[model samples]
Structure formats: structure tokens, C-alpha cells
Target chain A: MEFSLIDRIRERTAQARDDVRLGIGDDAALLAVPAGQELAVAIDTLVEGVHFPRGTAAADIGWKALAVNLSDLAAMGATPAWALLALTLPNADADFIDGLATGFAQLAQPYRLALVGGDTTRGALTISVAVHGFVPAGKALTRTGAQVGDLVMVTGTLGDAAAGLRLVQQGGQDDPRSAWLIERLNRPVPRIAAGLALRDCASACIDVSDGLLADLGHICAAGAVGAQIDASLLPRSSALLDWFDDDASLDFALSGGDDYELCFTVSPQKLAATQAELARLGCGATRIGRIVAGEGVCVRDRDGRQRATARPGWDHFAA
Target chain B: MEFSLIDRIRERTAQARDDVRLGIGDDAALLAVPAGQELAVAIDTLVEGVHFPRGTAAADIGWKALAVNLSDLAAMGATPAWALLALTLPNADADFIDGLATGFAQLAQPYRLALVGGDTTRGALTISVAVHGFVPAGKALTRTGAQVGDLVMVTGTLGDAAAGLRLVQQGGQDDPRSAWLIERLNRPVPRIAAGLALRDCASACIDVSDGLLADLGHICAAGAVGAQIDASLLPRSSALLDWFDDDASLDFALSGGDDYELCFTVSPQKLAATQAELARLGCGATRIGRIVAGEGVCVRDRDGRQRATARPGWDHFAA
Candidate 1:
């Protein structure tokens, strides 16, 4: 079974870049990184009953597996290069592995990332993807460069994924809007272009996989500064708000994760430049907060009431 | 359990690098590449019951999990930089996770790799480590560069892992030398230093994980040459021959997998230089064969008899 599944995966991965000197059949895949470019790498794992609901579509699982890792490269402002896949499934079904690999290859085609070396084994359904990308040495965006007086901004909408998960949890699977939200949860459009465009203007950046407040906390902690978020400034799609009540929806927006939005900081002096840059890139950027001179994070409502946010984040080892 | 395990991993990774601006605590690790270097990245996954035996020691498995990916970096002739660990366990246990993290931290410290971003979820025990290293652009080692007259060399001994697995399968726990073979099986070292030294002299390089014959077959297939292996040149520890008869043990030595040694090729003219450089680095190099103008690999006995080598290499998807 493992054998047949591997064959299917290998067949599916036959489409790759010319620079992939060695692909699936070797101990490790060999790739040709372009000269003068640093490779950016990131790995993400999704497990049954944890990262996704049981019985999720295999294709979506495959898509999410690559999507999340690509999101990391996007946050780093790097161009995609190559990827390695590690998959563990209960039984090796040729069709299922091929389906998953097909989804991955399709998504990777646009970015020119070649499928390289990987391993397959027997276990619960687990997909781990390690993706490599290229960026000029000094241009790889990091979380340490943000300053105290920078404007905190996010690309795209938030809370859709968290709300989508809730809807799936409640067994709400048939709404028209549910498709959009579920797609947001399952197939996030990694803001690769927006991140690259903001590379020069943004002080620091992160991919929002752990909610807005918590992810912003990372930038703040890395920069050793405080952050103040205006709840009114958070971006929301009408599709998200129409499905749930105001407070519940806002809660989802504040603490919900899996957004894959690029939350970043741009200096006050670079605001005009950043706005112009985003316009040229045809992406939306909303200023939701500001980096401050203190420590910790604070959020305030439009009515001047302080909004209390629990540690609304995912902890893998919290029993 | 996940939170504290991550904390322990965080504490253990402090020796990684100052350029790792944010490590272990962020959504994604932030790093700064050196001014004029490219990054090489690789990922590997190990699953309980599939990749390792049941009831394997947590410490050994942890060490091996990082070691295998490090071996990939070595194959690329990249110096280790940073690593991200994605660990999945059936149930969260602080002691087990801490012990595993301790093993990984201990191995990573010498390589200057830091624990970066990771994801934890509930599932069968699996560890997927994605490692990043650095090399100057256009100088990374590859499998396609081996020329027709290159001398193929291997680092360290081979087949002890197969012998060790035999003992474990037979439930033999009392041989005076049994521990040595068993430890070899449990902890295969990655020849990072040897791989680094071979970067300049080696035309093509690969790590011997899936048996020497099968792995070198990868180089031959990629380099479009046939290899003539000297069976007598195969390295086998004396302890590995204590129980098995000569023919059986020799067969194991020729085709056994899980020996994580470096198999590389250098031009015949550079053979003496290769030996001198390896000696300077205190690494063992055994000339096992030479590449010829054909394709595939053939192993010949001392008298030049064509010996039959059973294909015992691992195939990830083979039934």
C-alpha cells in the first residue's frame, strides 16, 4: 500500500522546474538556488482532528498543508523555490495520495516551486510540508525591525477563518456564505505579493496564523515595545459580519486564528510610501494599531472602553 | 504540556545564533542571513512504528529526528543555521517532550542551529524537523556533478545498523558487543564536517541512508555513469560479524539500510588531495569504487566475481 501510494505521488510530482537536479527518487532532492539569493525555509504540519476536522476533503488538506508553509515564505517576503513533502497516512491509497499531490502541484505551479524529496510512512493522516524560497540577503522581512512609532497594518480580512471553524463545528455546512468562510479557513490566499511589496516599507512583519492580537504580540515582543490596537480599525468583510452577532463576530476577529493575513508595521514616516506601495500592488492594507513605547498590548473600543482580550491563542501542549 | 515543552525547547536553543532575532516564541522565527551567503533548506519526518521501532527511546528518537535532516544539509554542503520542529504526540507528556527537546537541543548546539517556530498537535508520535543552513551561492554540492572517472568514497563504517536491527529483532540483549551495534542503529551520526570538507573536492555527493549501493545508484543515475564497487572495500565493524556467518553478514554489509554516512565522488586526480583533506578534518574516507562510462551500479568481489546484491533499500511508497 505504501508502495502504490508512493508511485502515485511520484507520478504526480513529475511536473517540476528545470533546476530540480534530483527529485522524488533520491535520498534527498537536489535543487539549484539562483545565485546571489538567500533561501527562505518554513515547515508546517497539519494533523487529523487537530488542525482540521476529521473527514475534511483530502484535496483541501493537501492545499492547506502547502498554503500554510507558503504563508511563512510570504511573510518573509521571499519568492517560492522548492518544497519537500512528508506524509503519513493510515493506509496508502494511490488515488488519495495522487489527489493530494495533484492539489499541491497545481498550487505550486504558479509559484514555480518544484516538488522535491519527501518521505511517506504509515500512521494517522498527517501532512508536513517544508518549503524553500529565495530573497535577496537583506530583503527578507523579519519581526525585529519594527520601531516604536510604527503603524500596525494587516493585509486582507480577519476573523473569517475562526468563524468558519465555528460554523463547521456547529455542523453548519450548507450556507452560501459558509462556502466563502470555509474557503477562507481551508484555502487562505497567502499574501505573497503584498508582503513582497511591503518589504522595503514595512518595519517588521508576521503571518497571522494565531489571531491578530497574539500575532501582533510577537512583533511587539520581538521589537521590545508595546502595542495599542483600535478595535474599530480592524478590517471585516460584510460576509463575516452578516453571519454572526456583533460581539461574537468581533471576538472571532480579535482572537480567532488561521487568517494567513500579513500583519506588519510601517514607520510613521513611511505611511504615505506604504499606502502608495499597496495601491500599486492592488492589495488592501488597514492600520489597526500602533507600536508604542511601553510593554504588553492594549485594545480600546471606539467608545473609549478598554477591551479585555484573553490569551485567545492556540497552545499545542496545553492539556 | 505543549506550552512547557516548547519553553524547554526554547531554553535549550539559546546557543543557536544572535542573528536569530526571535526564536521559539514567535509565529515564525526571524533570522538574518549573512551579508553574502545563500541558505540551503531541508526537511525530514520520522514516524513511530514506521521509521523507528515501537518503544524506541524518546531521547534517541529525538536525536535521530534532528540528525537525519542535518544529514540533508550536509549533503548540500551547507553549514547548519536554524531548525523548526513540528512534533506530534498521542498525548501530551511534559517529561517525554522535555527529554526529546533536550536531545535535540544538545545536538543542535554544536551545529549552531536554533529552535525556531513549530506546531504541535495530537496524533501518533511523529517528528518533522526542517533545517536551514547557509552556503555561498553556486557552490552547494549536488548529485548531478559526478564525472565519469571520479573516485567514489564513503565515510565511516556501514551495515552495523542492519546488524543492530537483527539483534533487536532476535531479542538478544546480552552480547558484550551488542550494545555497540544497537547504539549504532539507534543513533546514526551525520557526517556534517566530512561533508563540508568534501564540498570543494567532491564532484557529486549524497548521504548513504538507503544503503550504499542504492544511494550511490542515485548519483550514477543523475550523473549518467556506471559505478564499479569493490566489495572488499565495504566497511564493516568486526562486532557486526560476531554472530552471523560470513556470507550472510557480508550481504547485510552490502545492502543494509539506515547507515547515515556520506557517499561522495572526487576526480581521480584529486584522490590524494581528498585523502589529505579528510585526514586533516579527522574524518575516515574509504575508496569503495570508481565511476565508468556506463549506467547503473555493479558490485564485484575481490576476485572480480559479479556478486549478487539483493535490493534491500527502503522505498517510501513501495508495498
Candidate 2:
């Protein structure tokens, strides 16, 4: 039954491309790389419980599965070229599987990422996707390039997705604005163009899948420097403020996860040029922090004093 | 806790090449690709009950998890390049995770597949890996490449892995070769080199993950051709005979899966060249079948007579 079910899905897809050289039957699939380009690769896993609710909407599950993987490629400053999906479903539902595939095809078409190969089997519901993108040799974005005295910047507003999760947990009624926030939670837009644009000017960059503080800590750690983010400089969306009380507002921005925005550092010398470049791309850049000579991350209010507490972020194995 | 865990792992490994551009602690890792190569990517998932036993050795589970995805790249005729591992352990087991990493690093050393990025989370026992490889453009192997009348060939021997699984499940006493076959069951070496060797010669290719009949049926369906497999020519290891009597022996050879071997088709004119290439690589190739002009797969015995059977191969969800 599993074999037939897989066969049905495979039957509907196109066979291996002429250039594929090898496809879904052997120990591996092969591809012919065109001359003069390096492959950009990324992998992400969506477990039923860890990444999503057990009984969430199947369509949204499929959407987020592809979205996160694309987010990784975006962080690399590469244009998504191809993807392979590995799915484990508890039961054979032709409709559900088809719908999932439909969602993937729709998302991929916009990015021009072809679905090349994969494997399927019966198990707890899990989805893992590996994406391949192409970039000119030596052009990818990395986390180690930042230098001391670099200005920090981010895309999109923080804490909205986290706020949306709270609303869903609290059973927020179906209001239009809440729906938009929920949409942000379920369907994150990978900043592909923004990443491509920042490839040259940004010294070091990363996507804010983790909280702003935690994700920025990564940049500072990798670049061998300290960072100071001014709390006053943090961007807040009115929707988030409306949803959270004063005390919770800061917490949401500081500790929230699942915000697929880009946080990057550029040389202080490039500050003017950086703003000009970002404005050309029609995205605003906020100076939230600067890289310093020492290590560890520090946060200060407008008055410019350090406030210390336990680490603020999500941990997979948190008790 | 997760941040510290990542920091520890990063510290343990030496810094990567200058081309790494960026490393851990960022939202995404960055890389610089050398000029003139295309990337091949694949992903695989191992669930507790579906892919392996609930209590399989942790080391073996880790080994198989990466090996399976590596096999997918091998089938594509690409050189292994990089990998991202997403692990969902019930809880952090420093020793177990270390062992798993060791298993993966050991296999990867031979192929030079760099462990670049991944995420860890708490959930049911599951391991998902996405592997990326590189090939020249238009050189990837695909299931749709088979032409009418291509000679079908397989690597190494079949049925050994199946017999090994039976030994493990039934708790049989040790045979001289028990360890050998059990190892094969636990860690099937993907035909990485053999796959690359055949890139220029084979028209269509696939890995024998499912039973030979079922997997080959995929090639036929994808290539829009029929197949005739010579049952007598199918490679049967001597170790396989110990598990089943005469009647059931055929079943193991035909339907027993998990060989992790390559099954591919070459033109008759190229068969000699392909065989010579395999010999040069110290690999084995068995001429077990031929692609035909019609639909469905047929089996032929020593006398060249077709055999009739009510069923063929293992079906995961078979009632």
C-alpha cells in the first residue's frame, strides 16, 4: 500500500530531466553543474511537535516546511535554484499528500527552485527539505566577516510572529489584523532579494529565525567581537504593541522566536553607503547596535547602562 | 543551554577553510564555492519505527541516517560536498550525540563531505539529514534516462542486507559471517565511486532502496519502458542462503530490500565499456536484466521462460 501510494505521487511528476543524468531510484541522485557557478546548500527539519502544533492546518504545515528552508538559502545570499523534500507521513492520504505537494510547488515556482528528488516512508509526521542555490564563486554571505565598529541593522519588525503565536494560544477571535499576524507566523517570507542585495556591503549577516538578541549574539560570536544593541533603537510594530502589555512588550521583542528577518552588520565607514543601498532596495535599515572589541553581547537602554540577566532565547532542550 | 551546546561543538572542530566566509552562531552559515561546478542536493529522514527498530544501536542509527542520504547523492553521480544534520533526540545525551557525530564524521572523511549547518530540537526520536554534492551541469543521473533496449546492471550482491535483518530480529546465534552481514544491514556503504564512474555511460539510474522489483518498476514507469530481469543472473550472496530454504530463497533475492546498491541501465553498445570501468574501480556489476519496448517488468528463468507470481516484493503498508 505504501509502495502504491508513493507510486501514485511519483506518477504525476515529470520524469528525470535530460540533464538530470540520474534521478530517484539509485543510491543517490546526480546532477550536471554548469560551468563557473558554485552551489549554495541548506537543510532544515520540521518535526511535528518541536516546530509546529500536532494538529495544525496541513496546508500551513507544508508552507512553513518549505519557507524555513528557503530562509536558510536567503541568508546565504543566494538565489534558490532547487530543492529535495523528504516526508514521513503516518498514513497514506492521497489528498493530503497532493495538497502538500501543491503548496511546495506553488512556493517553489516563485523562487524557481525545481523539486529534483526525495524519499518517503511511514512514520511520525516529519518534513526535511534541503535547498540548493547558485552563486558566483566567492560571493556568499557569511557570519565571520564583521569587524569592530560595525553598525547593526535588521529587516521587518520584530516580535510580530511571536505575538501571533500568543494570540493563537489564547484563542484570539478571527480579526483581520490578527489573521495577518497569524499569516506571518505560518507563512514567513524569506528575504531572498534583501540577502542578495546585502551580499557585498554587509560585513556579516544572519536571518533572525531565533530572537533578535540570540541571533545577533551569533554574529558577534562568529566575528570575534562584542555587540551593544540600544533598546531604544529596536523597531516595534503597532500591531505587536496592541497585543502585548508594557512589561510583555519588551519581552516579546527580546525573547521571541520565528521572526524570519535579516540582521546584518556593516562597517561604520559604510553606514552612509549602507543606508543608500538599502533605500535603493526599498528596505529601511535601523542602527540597533555596533560591534565592539570585546566578546559577549550587551544590551542597554537609551540611558546607556548594561542590564544583565539569564540568557534570553529559545533552547531546543530547555527543561 | 542549546547555545552553549552549539558553542561546544564549534570549539571542538577546527575552523574551516577561509572560503567558509562564515561559521556557526549566525542565523545561517555562509560559504564560498569554487568556480566551475554544479551542486547536487538530497535529503532523508529516519523515524523511530519506520526506518529502524525502536532500540537500534545509537551508533548504527546515526551511521545509517547519513549513509542513506549520501547514497542519494551517489546515485546522482556527484561528488559529496556538504551536509546539514537536524537531530531530534528525546533529550541531550552527550555521549550518544558524540558517538553519532563520530559515525557521521568517519563516513564523511572518505567523501570529504563537510558538516556545515543544522538544528537540534526536543521531540520523538528522529534524525533528518540533507546532503549536497557537486557535479558538472547536465551530468546528474536520473530515472528517465533509460532508452529502449538498455542493459540493466546492479552493483555488488543483493539479499545480504535482508538476511542480516532477519538474523538481528530473530536473535540467531553467531555465524562466522554474522558480524559481516549485520554490519551491512546497519551500515550499507553507498556506491559513491561506482555511481560517479557510470555518469558518462549509464542512460538511466536509481538506487535499490526498495526491493529490486519495486524499485526497477519505478525506472520502467519513469522511462516509459518495460523490463525483463533474468532471475538466475541476480547476484545472491552465499550468506543469504542460510536464512531461507529453496522456495523462500528466491523471495529474499527478489523482494528483500535495503541493499543500498546501485541499479542502473547502460546501452548494449556501452555495456562493455561500463563493465571495464567498473573493473578499473574494483567494483562488481551483474547483467541481470534488459529494458524492453513495452510496459511492466517481467522475470525470466534460466530456460528463458517467464515466471508467474501473484505478488512481487515487500509493500510497507501491505495488509
Candidate 3:
């Protein structure tokens, strides 16, 4: 049973990685880290109903499972190289494995990421992926480096995934706008290239998995500084703006989770260069705010008055 | 929610590892792999009711979750280092986290295995652990190097965990023998010292998670060799021997899973040195078989006659 499942998953997710001395089918994978590099690792798990609604397509589950972890590497300015997956399911289904593996391989192939090792078990549907990447020593982007007066920037749009989740939950999928938003929720594009572009210049970096306010709050907490973002400047896709009112869009942009975009800080001096680097990758940055000498993230309205703080983002254990 | 969970886990699992540049507070972990060493990675998942009994202590679950993955690293002759945990629980209960984290830390502390990063999600009770370890380049043990004349030896005793599992299912835990057996089931040691000892000499190695015959069969399959074992020579713990008859004990020793002991092949030329190496580590090995020229594993009776093959090991996805 184990052999067959591994064979099937391998058939779909196979990639040639010269550094992976031994890939799947081994007790543990052996990988060689290139000289003069630090290894950046990240792991995330997706559970049915909790991470995604029940009956979500297996392919989507697989794609999102890997995307979220790769998003972490992207947040760290790491080049993804290998991943290990632990998939738990109600039972071993060939078609499910095929779809999931295909989806995983689809996202992994562009980065030359190899599925090194994984375990499959019978249980509630859960997928855990651990990613390993390479970054030159001393150059990893971290959340503790934000300084006062640094410009706060974000890659791509923010509220599309949150809007997508809302439309899917409301059964409002008839419109093309809904379709686009739903795709954002189901398939978040990890900004790996943007992370690379920001590595040299970004003062601080984090991936927005939880809403912008909550994740930015992490940067604030780490650096012992605060951030003030203008709500009027939050980036939102056209589809999201067309589907929701201004107030709703603003709220979603501030607190909608599942946007796998990079929220980073850059010294004011490097703003133009950072913007140019990101532009070359076609994922331009939007200046939403600046680092300030305070605590916790503060959102300012169009009138420059602070908005009343809402519950930051979706809390997995919130009552 | 994520911060609190991380803080709790970090408080319990913290170790002063200078190589971990950044840990749980960031988007991902940055770990410096030692110069001239390759990284070995392994992942495993445990689900309530499937991997362990529903009422199993959170501590045991925690210990076993990390232990099983460490067992994989042990199979590769790697020195354990950092780990990432993705925990899925039905609800956020403080006491459960305390017990689980305490248990996980208890096992991890001895190895100085730091918990670097992870995700906590809401779902059916499950724990997935990914371990990263370092092995000197080109010296890591693998399953594909066995020769036809190599001796098949296993670290420590077998059948105790399997026997213990049987006793628990039968509600026979009132006996001291049952108590010892259950402990074996709950906390099977991942013979790190034995693995290190075998690194220089063992031709092939695998961890006996799915019973010895089944796991040794993996070595055979990898090296395209066969094996023959004598039932009479199989090692069984005193508690296992005292509680079960010869036939039952032999069956458990042969096909009982979750042992987490190393089953490896050593050449005849290195037998004395290998024995001395393991004896020094206090996890003495016993030789029960040898690799042969052809096909699947064959069992031999005490009388030197062929015995019929039984079904091999536990299959997680068996229908």
C-alpha cells in the first residue's frame, strides 16, 4: 500500500534536482546545500473545512498547501529547492493523489522544487508541507529589521483573496468578478521574485497569510516599532472593487486573511530602486504607510484620522 | 492565536542552538548547515485513532510524533538538529498544549533539537513533524548498498511494542508486563547512538517502523538482494517472552510494527568492530539473518526448514 501510493505520487511530482542526492522512497532525503548559503525552512498545514471549505477540489488543496509554504520562503528571500509533504486522507484514492500531486508539481516545477520525501496516512484530510530554500549567508530578509521612517510596501493586491472567500461562502459565484476573486483565494501566487528583488533593500519583510494589519503587527512587535498605513492607499484588485463597497473593500484590505503577498519595509533611500526592481518582475509595490515610533499597527482613514481598531484578522481559535 | 501557540511551544522546546539565526517568531526559520555537511530531512504525521488510541496522552503523542521522524534521521546516520511542527487540533485547549509541548520538549531537549517553525490549525487531532539533521557529505547511510553476503542485524529487542499494543487493545494493562510493553509502544527509542556507530560500517540501514521483515524488505528491494532470517534467533524482550507463548512472541517479533529500531546490514569483515561499537552504546545488536542473492524475504524455522510467509507489517492505507 505504501509503495503504490508513493509510486503514484512520485509519478506526478517528479522533478530533477541535482542537489537532492536521494529523493522520495527513502527513509529520509539527503540534500546538499550549496556552499556559502544558509538554509531557510518553512512548514504549513491545511485542514479541510478549517483552511478550506469541505468539498474543495483536491487540486486546489494541493496547490494551496505548497503555495503557503513557498510563500514563507518567499518572505525570507529564499530560493525554494525541496519540499517534504505529509498527507492525511480518509483513504488512499488514486484520482485524488493524481490531482493533488499534479497541483503540487505545477507550482513546484517553475522554481525547480523537488518533492524530496513525504508520508501518506489514513485520517482526516490534512496536508503538511515543509519547504527548504537557499539564501546567501547574512542576507535573509527578516521581520526584525524595520526602522523608524522606513516606507511600508506590499507586493500586488491584498483584498482579492479575502473577497474571494466571502463570495464563495455567499454562493455568489455567478459573476466573472466572483470567479476571479475565488481563484485568488484558491490559488494565491507566492511572490518569490518580489522577495528576491527586496532582499538587498527591504529593511523588514513578512508574508501576509493572516491579514495585513495582523502580519504587519508582527513586524512592529519584532522591531519594537509601529506602522501607520493609510486605508485609502491599500491595494485592491478591480474585481474586488467592483464586487464590494468602499467601506467593505477597505475593511477587507485591512483585515482579510489568505493574501499571500509580501508586506515589506524599505529605507526611504531605497524606495525608487526597490520599486524599479519589483517592476521588472511585473509585481509592483504599493506604498501603503511608513514605520513610526509607536506600538501595534494603526490604520488611518482618508482624512488622516485613526480608524477604530477592529479584531485584527481571522483567529483560528477565536470563540 | 499563532503567536501564543508559538510562544507556548517555544517556551517548552527552546534550546540554545547557535546555528538557528532566526526561529519561531519570523515568517520562516534560517538555519546554517555546517560546512562540509549535507542535510537530511524527514517528515511523518500522526492522527488520533489511526496512529495512536483516541485517549492517548498528549505527551505520548508529542513524544512519538517527534520520535518517529527522528527515527528516520537515525536511519540515515544523521545528527539531529532543528524541527518544524504542524499541529492540528480540534480546539485550542491550554492544558492539552502544555502536556503536548512538555512531552515534545522532553524528547527534543536531549538531542538539542530546536523547534524552529511550524503552523497550528483547527482540524481533527493530528501532528506532523519535519526534522532536519546534518550528516557528513557522502557518508550518509542509505538502503541501496547491501551486498549478498552482508549480515542482517537489528538494534535492541523487537516485539515489545507490538505485544504492548496487543495487550492495550485487549484491556490487559493491569499486568506489569503490559505496562512495560505499552511504554515500548508509546516511546520507542530512535537509536541515535547505534545509527552513528553504524555509519562507517553498515552497508545498508532502515528503521523498523513497519515491522522488521517489512522494513528489511525495503533494504532488499533497494539493493535488489534477498534475506533469510531464523525465527529462533529473533530477539524478544523479557516481558514479551514472559507473557506470550513461543509462537505468539515469534509472530510479534517478526511482523510487529512501530519498533523504531535500526535494522541494518554489515559485512562479515566488520562484524567484530560493529558489535563492539554497538555494545559501547548500550544498544547491542543481534544477528538474525543475512542478505542473499535473490528475491523476497524467506523465513526459516528453528529446525532449518522453510516457513510459510505471513502478511508483512501494518499498512496505513490497506482496504
Interface RMSD of every predicted model, in angstroms: 3.5, 3.1, 1.0
What value does the TM-score of chain B take for model 1? 0.95
How displaced is residue A232 in candidate 2, in Å?
Answer: 2.5
Provide TM-scores for the models. Answer: 0.85, 0.88, 0.98
Fnat per candidate: 0.35, 0.53, 0.94
Which candidate has the top score in TM-score? 3
Off by over 4 Å in 3: A1-9
Per-residue lDDT of model 2, residues B1-319, tens digit only: 3444344434444445554655554444555544555556677778786677666777788788888888877777878777777777788988777667666666776765666777776767778887777776667787777888899899988877777777877775266657767787788898899989999999887887777887788889888999999888888876776656654556666777778888899999999999999989988999999999998889887788887644565555555
How close to the true structure is residue A307 of candidate 3, measured as C-alpha lDDT?
A: 98
> Which CAPRI category fits model 1?
acceptable
**Which of 1 and 3 is the better model by lDDT?**
3
| Steric clash pairs (candidate 3) | none
CAPRI quality level assigned to candidate 3 from its DockQ score: high
lDDT of 1 by residue, B1-319 (tens): 5556667877877673666654555344546767555566667789887677777778888888989888888887888887777888988776788788888877887877777677777788998887777776677787777888889898888888888888887887467669988888778888889878888999999888778888898899889898999988887778887767777677777778777888999998999999898888888899999999999889899899988876747765556
Q: Please report, as a residue range, the 10-residue window in candidate 3 chain A with the lowest summed lDDT.
A: A1-10
- Report the number of the highest-lDDT candidate: 3
- Per-residue C-alpha lDDT of model 3 across residues A1-319, encoded as one tens digit per residue: 4555456656765767779988887889999989888989999999888888776778888899999999999999999999888899997788888788778877987888888888888899999999999999999999998999999999889888889888878887666658888888888889999898788999999999999999999999999999999999999888889989998988888899999999999998999998988898899799999999989999999999999867797788887
Which lDDT tens digits does candidate 1 get at residues A24-65?
A: 554445456565565576678899888888867777888888
